[model samples]
Target chain A: MSITWPLFIQVTLRLLEGFETTCLIFALTLVLALPLGLVISFGSMSKFKPLAYITKVFVWIIRGVPLMLQIFVVFYVPRLIWDLPAFSRFNAVILAFVINYACYFSEIYRGGIESISKGQYEAGQVLGMTKTQIFFKVILMQVVKRIIPPMSNEIITLVKDTALARVIMVAEILKVAEEYAGYALIWPLFYTAVYYLAFVGILTLLFGFFERKLSYYKV
Target chain B: MAFLEVKNIKKKFGSNEVLKDISFSLEKGEVLAIIGSSGSGKTTLLRCLNFLEKADDGVISVDGNLLFDGSDRSTTSDKNIRRKRLHFGLVFQSFNLFPQYTALKNIMLAPEMLLKERAKKEKLSAHQKREEHEKIVAHAKELLDSVGLSAKEKSYPCELSGGQCQRVAIARALALSPDVLCFDEPTSALDPELTGEVLRVIRNLKSSDRTMIVVTHEMEFARNVADKVIFMSDGVIEEAGTPEEVFDNPKSERTREFLNRPGF
Candidate 1:
């Protein structure tokens, strides 16, 4: 059946709303996970053996499991093990995404931070900067510049991964499109690709802008 | 009490001892140059002086303040070491200017972040704090001017040449006005031609009454600028004396060997 212009607008607006939720999940996960990733990186890189080992193993487990499976585990395991009520689908989806992405981001952060020469730290220390001062003032921005490329890649992947929220019954873009597909209109499913492409295209441009801005650091 | 005193500083890396019983004392306005081949622990000794590398056994005093007693380096909290570290400013061979900062910002950062934090802790009035901030900014500008990089104050480390970056690094180190300045092969990272520009800046510092400890391979600079010269041979001081005594009338076989190498 051919869709009229009004019908197309209606479908597009509905998908846009769904995309809003997708963006929210993406944004919140990033906001929480980025700083959390840095903290986890410190843990993974800690001089204390037990803390470092535990953090590394946890990161490994999170990264080793599939995101979809992690979503299931996040949604079900708390209730299974503790007899707690299930969390909201949005909460469960974000929880899983945040934990999984944080592990990935922490590894990237650790690599970026560790790759900095020991001399940089020494330079800061000699200036009488405290450890916290050294990390925040000297190390943090340089680490941000170094990690941006890999970080942007992960973020772009997160744009696509937001669809996985559907596994937890969160009505993000893909799930919304799937609902339309039940009406024998497959065009809406194809239509979902347009949203993802536009979203990712915008992200790619944003990341390109950041990379250009940070190029001044020169490694 | 000397202006700077380092007593029996020893350091180890795993199975290898990098610095062994290194001791030195500097008077106010005196410059000491440490010359040695790579792996001789000259750099390590300098690093230990600033508590950058924890010494296994030693005592360091700067302006009569005890930095740490190496008998228990671990027991010395990081806070104590960092506070004591303010007494010494170190310039690296690689000119580790913060790459993300402009040359002026590199000089301004330590003073701004540090002095402001200290002022904040004292609960200084905003007007007082503002005065402190302005003072640091003006001082940073003056330092940039002194280094002959006033025109390049806005330039990032990547934009500056090797000598310019080292000068900026020197300016940054000097921004805090530490009791002593330590240079670890400051010119080794520059081109032979560019090395002259940095050496000239350092030579200017020689007459300024700043106590300095330089670890370098520039024999001519060592002879000309240093009041005393130390020849480090395999983690120990093979010879240390006035420039004439060490350079002209070499005594130790190892010191003579290092000075009389094929290049010399």
Candidate 2:
């Protein structure tokens, strides 16, 4: 039960590598999901019946199933259906993460867009702006302002969910914890929670700063 | 041809036919006011003129451009429709300004982007573009001055009152230099004192060169400002005539019931 300071530092450094992977997935998923969610929200709210229905159904299916099932499906479904080159486990993990978060983000997208009055659209059109221009210049920032707090909450959750990647042995942070635990035991497993809580705390501070900076915006 | 025209326009929204074969036309400088009870399609009809809501049938041509040609909705290109849309300006029931942008930037954006292509088409040089920016920004300032909101030039929408927001919305619309201006309940979201402020701004634009169409519930304002009044109910024009003709005379029971309300 003797404390081992040098080994502890090494274990922390090893865990840092896993934390980097976690941050990578977190950042990439957000980079992909924000715009993808906007596009999905647009399609779901489109005047075209077919595109609207398709987007809605797609989001619904992704949201309905558990993330674990989505992870398994992404890993196996393409190979089963196409018989093409198998995807790397990392690719499957990203695919599952993107699709799952995109759906959640789409609902936030939809809510933010819908909360804007139809009058805004009319005003944009009357000003001779195209629909796309209106969405970006007028509707876009409002949607961002509206969705940020909710988006931040979901995003921090996504940071922790990177451990879920370990379910498929993707070698993310939790996997790094278990690896160290086999050699040393006990506390390393508990140490994994510290990384998550610290990451989430940082995320919360960032979101608070963002919201304050955007305070001038009013719908 | 009239400067703007709406011919036999019909619009239905999800089993609700809101406008049935409505037709209207306007010269370049006239102001037309539309008054009706709630669900009377006054707003819907105004929306159709700008192609904000596409009419299920008939045509709305602005500045002689075919905005809606009664083709299958799928066949109509949004791109083509948008080109015609630049011909009109609109103010809404809620002051739908881009809340994040300051009043100056709110008015500057559409002109900067949409008219950048326009400037290129006209082959203006960079010096001319810079000059145009100064002129536009000044014009926007002048517009706010006319509307009594010049002091609020740098304020966000949240910092302004509802009336001031509506005035800024009007200024933003005017910055487009559109052929026609449309108001959907300009005072509906304002308090009485604020409503007077907004209506005063709209009233001062009486001598403006552009045409105007208003969907308003303010009978006194409409009776004073409008050359003619078009009454709507149940997705159709219940009656159309001068304010005196429609408000004073009894043509349709619906219009009668509307004007006879405690205030009107």
Candidate 3:
């Protein structure tokens, strides 16, 4: 079989449109998850019993369910249960990814926070720092540094999982390939691997740079 | 009431009483050494006065202002007692210098944020604030000089030796210039040789008019620098008196036996 440049360009342009959707979901999830994860971590660690319990239970439910199922539920359940108009397909995909990743990030947050010794907290108190000051000024950077490796792994996984949105025909890269494959030739289906491998490849290097920047943490 | 007073202070960990009716007082500039074996509740008493432990039942006063009564340790309405704590400084055995911060930032943190947080910052004019900041830096330098850590300002805690770390801890404590400095086993973490190095710095502090309360096992330190000595055991005061009277002629059998031993 011969490699064809003209056909490649046609598929690449169509794939690019689908790639744009993937990028949008990735960007939105990060913006939402970073702060939302912090809020969830705080809730899980709250001194009040009820808030802590509720946060933990919510995290457990989200984490236990499949992301594909969650996407379906979040996208379709409101329409089914309430007989209301459904959210836009793109919005539903974003909402699902945000909720899923936030739970994962919360666990990473909890593990990072718990890894720091209790002695550190007592030391902060002895200096007369309020609990807020201790968390932000003392423990915050350490948690960020500690959570990066696990968070990066999940993020790369998230990039690939954007293809999961194609399940609902949201026109992700793979779905774009499916359209072109049926029309022109089936080879574009194989070409979809090019986009995925490239996306994941770039993310890997970005995480490497991020980890190097945080090397001062030493832990 | 004395310059610093503790009355009926009790601390318990779920029914295992760490301190029972612990009471003591100190005049300004006096060095009172609290000596006892491990688990004697010596550290607990010091923690109580600072409201670090939140005593189960107690009344504590500093400079004629009651700090902790029953449960709450002086709310915003009780500014006088709050003022007293700001005047108290604590040094610990572990040196507790924030691992992430430089020594200079560690010393400057409390005075800078604490005053700003309490809104007493208006007392300092911009010129004075800059001057005060410079003075804290200068004083932190002097304190580091006094404790023999002048070369270690930029180093993190992990890079420093145990002796250097303890000196930084002392510098961090003295940076506040509190009315009283309370040490909770300050030398317990160091070897015998390094113990002398820290004790020498502490002995140098004796000539100044600052009040000090030292929780220690070093009998010689208690005898050499203390104006008064307190021996505690099993959550209660066993004996307390002038250094000479307590060490030279101990009244309690417990004190005599404890002093003669190599360890407290």
Candidate 4:
């Protein structure tokens, strides 16, 4: 248990490698989920009863269950039901995270969009803009401004949730720390806090910037 | 033929009737003011004309072009409705300017979209599109100037006062150059002092011969500015005439009582 430069550097490098995986999962989940969430929100809000109901029920199921269990389901259910080869642990983690986050994000999107007063739509209609034109041109930015605060909260949560990837042996940063702890070196596990805090700190500053940029308008 | 004619415009909200057989006509260069108590359907009538609400039964014609026919489903298609909506621009009482855009961009947006569409249809070159966009900007500036908001072009709706925001909304509505402009109580959301500035803008618009329908609670504004005044009660026109006849010598008991109310 001697504290040495080599041991510190080795632990740092190993954690950095695992942190890369964490960052990848977080980045890819966000890139894929944001737009997919919007589309799902539209489906939930659709005028078509069946589509809306089905989307709502799907969102309901995804949100009602625990994320870890969902990961297990995603990883194992295909093999169980279809007799197919198991998906890579990383892919399963991604699939579960995207589906779960997209559902949560869809609810946030729906709330932001529906919170806009009817007057805005009426104003656009009276100006002779089509529904599509009205949405993209008039409503979209306002919705973006309104959703930013809530979206940032969910996004920060996603940063922490990347730890869940370790359950399926995806070997994210926390898992690397756990491996060090198993060697009876407990301090390296506590050291994982530095990486997470730094990552969340950057995200907080970025979201703050966006919120300020959109502060020119009040929704 | 009337420049704008609405025949038997009826609207209902589930079990409740909001507008009942509301019929009126406006000649070019005239201002028609509708005065009514709340729930009397004045706003609903304006909404129907602007295609914000589809009247359960009606025929609307602007400049002799039949824009809406409730009996014929063909005329009520989404594309046709949007096209017909261009004939009437509505200014809401709440002054619903797009908050994300500046006052000038709020006015310019619809026209910019329209010009872009037309440019695409005519296969105009990129330079021509830019020229058209410049024209739209110039026109929006002119409209802002007309509403006495020339210096506030860069201000967001949140930055502007209620009256200034309404003026921007007025300019935004005028940017489309509809055949008729409609206002659903433009001053209702403003303070008594702020109300004067917006009312002044509407009065100025009148001298320039803009045809307008104003649904208002301001009895004085209605009486002083309207060429024709309509008194609505219980989803019907209680009285319709020149301001003198309607306000000074109301024919219906309801109209007379409404006019005598303390605020009026």
Best-fitting candidate, scored by DockQ: 4
How many backbone clashes are present in model 3?
A: 0
Residue-by-residue lDDT tens digits, candidate 3, B18-40:
99888889898899999988899
Write the candidate numbers in order of decreasing DockQ: 4, 1, 2, 3
For model 2, residues B93-113, the per-residue Cα lDDT tens digits are 887888889987887878777
Candidate 1 lDDT over A1-219, as tens digits, reads: 799999899999999989999999999999999989989999999999999999999998999889999999999999999999998889999999999999999999999999988988989888878778889888889889988989999999998899999987899988999999999888999999998999899999999999898887686
Clashing pairs for model 4 are: none
- The digit string of per-residue lDDT tens for model 2 on A1-219 reads 555999789778888899888888788888888778777888998999999999999998999998888988888888899987777888888889998998899899899889988867766777777778888888888888899989998998898888888877888888988986777676878888898899899889999999999897677
Best by TM-score: 4
Q: Which regions of candidate 2 fall more than 4 Å away from where they truly are?
A: A39-61, A69-86, B1-28, B56-79, B119-125, B233-258
Which regions of candidate 3 deviate over 4 angstroms? A181-194, A217-219, B71-84, B118-132, B260-264
lDDT at A54, model 1: 100
**Which tens-of-lDDT digit does each residue in B1-264 have in candidate 4?**
999999999999999999989999999999999998999999889988888778899899999898888898887766677788888889989998999999999999889888878988999999999998888999999999999999999999999999999999999999988889999999988899999999999999995457999999888898899999999999999999999999889889999898888864
Give candidate 3's TM-score: 0.90
- C-alpha displacement of B253 in model 1, angstroms? 1.8
Over A114-203, each residue of candidate 4 has an lDDT whose tens digit, in order, gives 999998988888887878998999898989998998999999999999999998999999999999889898998889899999999999
Model 3: colliding residue pairs: none
Candidate 3 per-residue C-alpha lDDT over A69-171 given as tens digits, one digit per residue, 9 for 90 to 100: 9999989999999998998998999999999999888889999999987756665666666778878877887778888889988888888888889777798
lDDT of 1: 0.90
**Which parts of model 1 are misplaced by more than 4 Å?**
B71-79
The TM-score of candidate 1 is 0.95
From the highest TM-score down, the ranking of the candidates is 4, 1, 3, 2
